[model samples]
Target chain A: MLPDSAPLSAATATSPAEEVLTVEHVSKSFGDNHVLQDFSLTLHRGENLVVLGKSGSGKSVLIKCIIGLLPVDAGRITVLGQEVGALGHDELDQLRTKVGFLFQSNALYDSMTVRENLLFPLRRHWMADRRGQEESMVMQALDDVGLVETIDKMPAELSGGQRKRIALARTLIIPPEIILYDEPTTGLDPITAREISQLIREVQQKYTTSSIIISHDMNCVRLTADRVALLVEGRCYAEGTFQELQQLDDPIVREFFV
Target chain B: MNSTILAETGAITNFAWRFFRHGFRPRYEVQELLYQCYVVGYQSLPLVGITGFIMGIVLTLQSRPTMAQFGAESWIPTMVGLTIVREMGPIITALIFAGKIGSSIGAELGSMRVTEQIDAMEVAGTNPFKYLVVTRVLATTLMLPILTLLADAIALYAAYIGINLKGVTTLALFTNNIISTLTFGDVVPAVIKTFFFGFAVGIIGCYKGYNANKGTEGVGRAANSAVVVSSLVIFLLDLLAVQITSALGLN
Candidate 1:
């Protein structure tokens, strides 16, 4: 495992040698059921790390704890060098502005049109731009996801695949330094899933941002992950690159990708 | 016979208690409240307005014949005004509000959660409770009173039209009679009760929608629960308010 505070150099794409996130010895439990036990991982400035696990293996729970969605019963999660739990409300909102999350369901606000969906974040953060730079920024994000033509359409009008793509566009509209993707391609057809995988790769290549992708799909783990972690028995059972994991003889590792 | 009603009452009480625990906590959502207001208040105004007008006219017309037997037809305006301000206005307006706002909130939030939008907000570093529940509750609290007042006004106007349908009372006399009969006690108590009605409806909607589980079935349950609970709360609060006002010699 990478050291929690290990400094970044070549992988530091956003700034001059910065470690994006450091999570150390995190443990979470729901009463008697332990979801995450002593889980730890460090995300570099610009790399994409995919987490793979079987169903009910605490993959989503680990990321949720890191993002402060599910309060960690134990351990530490630090993002951009600030402790996640110790931050107050304003601080948490500030930190959140820096991070973008793509939910498993796309989570596009159904009340809004695609244009409005893209504007939700912009409207919330409009205080930052005195000059109003969002006209070009929104168009650019939508263009990146190949959704420039569907700006006026509501989410209910869009197909499942289109919704995921629009969600991806919204994620980039924030220009976040770190992205947490929760099952980015779970319910899509193989072609759409592959397209989503390609979009993930494109996002990684285009943005000088780091990401933690939570997916059970091995093809995604194989295609986009620079490193992979298997969450089993409420802990990181194994951590390595896809190739290294594939080569392992252990039943847990073999069973995950097989 | 009592068992079924007792069971239903118990279920509602338990649900209200859960909502209290979740809603009272800091970082609870208020976004759904705004959406609810938009749906329950703004979108529903036209329907309630029309209904209130017709209700007033019909009530005035129906009452005139009965009062005419005692040559008390001149009391029509006072009677209509009292009915609108005291009872018909509040109950009908609330039920209409329940049908529109309560159901929409329940269905929308239930669907959002089932679709995982609530979870997405949490991951995106936004508090779902603040974003979803708080706005809707606050909006309802603010809007419901305004809606009820509007409904009461329209209903009174309709009652005037109803009075004119059968016999003639000059608008001035009609106006004077309505004004003289309307006490601050009647108006204030009725208005005060509306705020509770809105709060109950908003809170019940948020509670049902937020805690919804089970998928498509959950959405139905949420909507069903919201309407049922909000309607009950409206009547219960009305009963309590009437008692308090009577005790204080305001009735």
Candidate 2:
């Protein structure tokens, strides 16, 4: 067992190239709750799929099923042609290394500084050889988020928006083929939100990796998403471009967007 | 049966089985385990140690005169050792752990769940349970016994000191008295129960925190449940452990 002090560095994550993620009709429930019901969504390589929903709409649960965080009562999730829910622990981890996540609250380890956080995915022996390149990539990712100045700071030392950006940097530094963002713009001000939206688009353009963003922010949905899906009542109620979705005049879409 | 209670019980049972399975798996999440130990064990030493010392000393001091009234002061060492190692030692340490490690784990996972970070792990083709929950639970299970051992030692030492204050006795004589009264029977059961204490603390903390919902309120629920449930489980498990240990003739 590697000592607990070992860092999770970004160097260990990169995969061959672009990979598409697919989630078929997946349904999940905790007893009577029916948390996710017949949820279906498709993510293409390098495409950004934005999910917008109300507070209890199961938008997040849909993502969880796709990545096997929560098991589906039925259906399948395939990432890069491998079935996600069917895989064993090691296989699942191997798949995780290829995906990056930007937590809504910027779940940076409070114990570590920005530099240590940036090197987290790469510091372990598994990523030891790729450490230098990962470090450089992290620097570039931090630069992309306008957080290059705060490398020495702890998560508490940064502003909320800055923390979100650091989370973005953490997600991007690993240079994974898929990146998922949850509430990427929820707590930010208009200007900062715009900056984040721009950054998301920039990442899509740069990495050409598939991305799925879970958010209630309409502006974010409109700006960075190539296609939008409204996850409600345990299912993908609707899926389309923002324009297509906006034109539908569905009550759920109106409630979410307006 | 009411589903909430029934399901909770079933969930507890199911989680217990998985914990044993994944806890010993290769790639032991060594770092996460250490992080938990550091968070759950090392940092908690001072508090648990102090608690154990006072528990032993106070128990001895209070009971000494009482026992002396019955001409039974000699039971001080065995009594202190039994109280510290078997019950107070594990229970107090777990409560401290429930406060420190439990709340932290709850708050951490609760915030992650609310923020959708845990979801992101899933979309990235990661098993959030394995990465987040299993590693953490395993870490707690492994470290709690070690912490209990340390607390047990500290408490016994404090009991000796307490005994010295009120009466006259040589180190050898005091030590001999303790040694003669104490047996593997006392130590083994006391130590064995601690593992349960630790496991209960970790598992209850994880279950409450990981299953939290309702955003900000979820975080509160997680922290609150971590402490309340783990604390309750300590007593429940202590009862079960004692029953089993006595039944097995380890008493």
Candidate 3:
């Protein structure tokens, strides 16, 4: 396992040769309030790119656009080499099987048990050969998240941290090529948040999957991010390693470091 | 106010259009639909049955004194049966259903929307509209009519009990009296309109819930407005049904 405080230089020394996802000059707005304006970023295979921003700085919007949940007003989002806006419903659904998203709320179906929640995506994107292995797959995913004991429990029964872990496990069940985490450590305690940050790194190493994590949590950024992009005023204001950005003299970037 | 109403109308129309487009396609959510049917139809029987029973008994007792003045006490069975089947049973049950199922669906889906469960489903490669909205709408549409019919039967049975409480009338005679006066026009028109009522309740509940916003407060608003709008729609549809039946000479 990689050291908990491994620097970005050591962590991503051998950059994988791939551009799994890209947002090119994407702009999105709700009414007069522009949330994202010409914001662009890239995720290479096996890299954790954290988009650091204050709440409402369009961090979540950028993730949603990448996953095709929200359409961009201008520019394009291409995931796994397919233009998100150009795809049809069926095509998008197919593409989504290769991309997992973890919502800030955990968003586990309240009515379903953890097992059923994990099985939902697997069944939705079912392949005939994997029919009988669903049980094993679910167990393995739960094991990965260290929540196998909570499989039968409803989401409401779990603690906030457990719920967040379960949501991550659900995302990992399908083994998506890319994972988008929206405020994964937002509501957890410091200890749980740090644990989640470590878990994020563990998942990256295990699955070799690209990820875009949206967070303003400095500790989480230090622990999980290989590269951090600062989102400010609906734009990618600065981009660098966490330590590099921390040393920068810019006031806007320093505000976050402070 | 007018603009808000117009905007709501346009939004509902668009939502309905999406439903039609997605609802009829393949990969149907049969399991969810069945589960919803049980929740909406079977679980609601007790409330609907009690309301129907009370309605029948109250109508009989109230009409008894009036009928006695004309020495038409024996005609109570026919009048009560016709009234229950034609209007009272369907309307009262639909209103109650609006309160129960419509609000339930609205709140459930509204909570889902606010909590991002719907978005999660979409990310999971499931069409949440098909899995949640369509199943619920179909269940309400299919189940409401059945519930109304059952309520009508219970009300008629209660009317029989009410009649017996006052004077001893043979069961055969009461049945014959009511059956003889009831025509295909009376039964068919009432039954047919209930389908529309069911559709209205289902569609309106879904429309409100699916678009719910503003968090927990929005959930409450969705549930409350679903019941209110559906109840209003039930009455309006009932009025329209009456006019259509009269025009078609089925009145």
Query: By lDDT, who's the top model here?
Result: 3
Q: Order the candidates by DockQ, highest first.
A: 3, 1, 2
Relative to the real complex, the DockQ score for model 3 comes to 0.77
DockQ winner, 2 or 3: 3
lDDT of 1 by residue, A171-200 (tens): 888789999998998999999899999989
Pitting candidate 2 against candidate 3, the one with the higher lDDT is 3
Task: State which candidate has the highest DockQ.
Answer: 3
Query: What's the lDDT for all of these models?
Result: 0.81, 0.76, 0.90
Question: Residue A192 in candidate 2 has what lDDT?
Answer: 91
Candidate 2 residue-wise lDDT, B1-251, digit = tens:
59887898788778778777766665456676667667777787888888878877888898898889999887778777667766788778878878888888888888877766565455444455666788778678878888888888888888888888988666676667767777798878777777777777778778777788999998998989888878888888888887898798986
Which lDDT value does model 1 have at B119? 70
Q: List TM-scores for all candidates, in order.
A: 0.83, 0.76, 0.95
lDDT of 3 by residue, A1-258 (tens): 222221222123454569999988889999999898777788888889999999988899889888888888999899999999999999999999999999999999999999999988888777898989999999999999999999999998999999999999999998899999999999899999999999999999999989999999999999999889888888778888888888888778899998
For candidate 1, give the docking quality class from DockQ: acceptable
Q: Could you give me the TM-score of model 1 versus the true structure?
A: 0.83
Considering lDDT, which of the candidate structures 1 and 3 is the better prediction for this target?
A: 3
lDDT of 2 by residue, A14-36 (tens): 33444488777778888889877
Q: What digit string (tens of lDDT, one per residue) describes model 3 on residues B7-100? A: 9988888888898999999888899899999999999999999999999989998999999999999999999999999999889999999999
Error of 2 at B32 (Å): 3.2
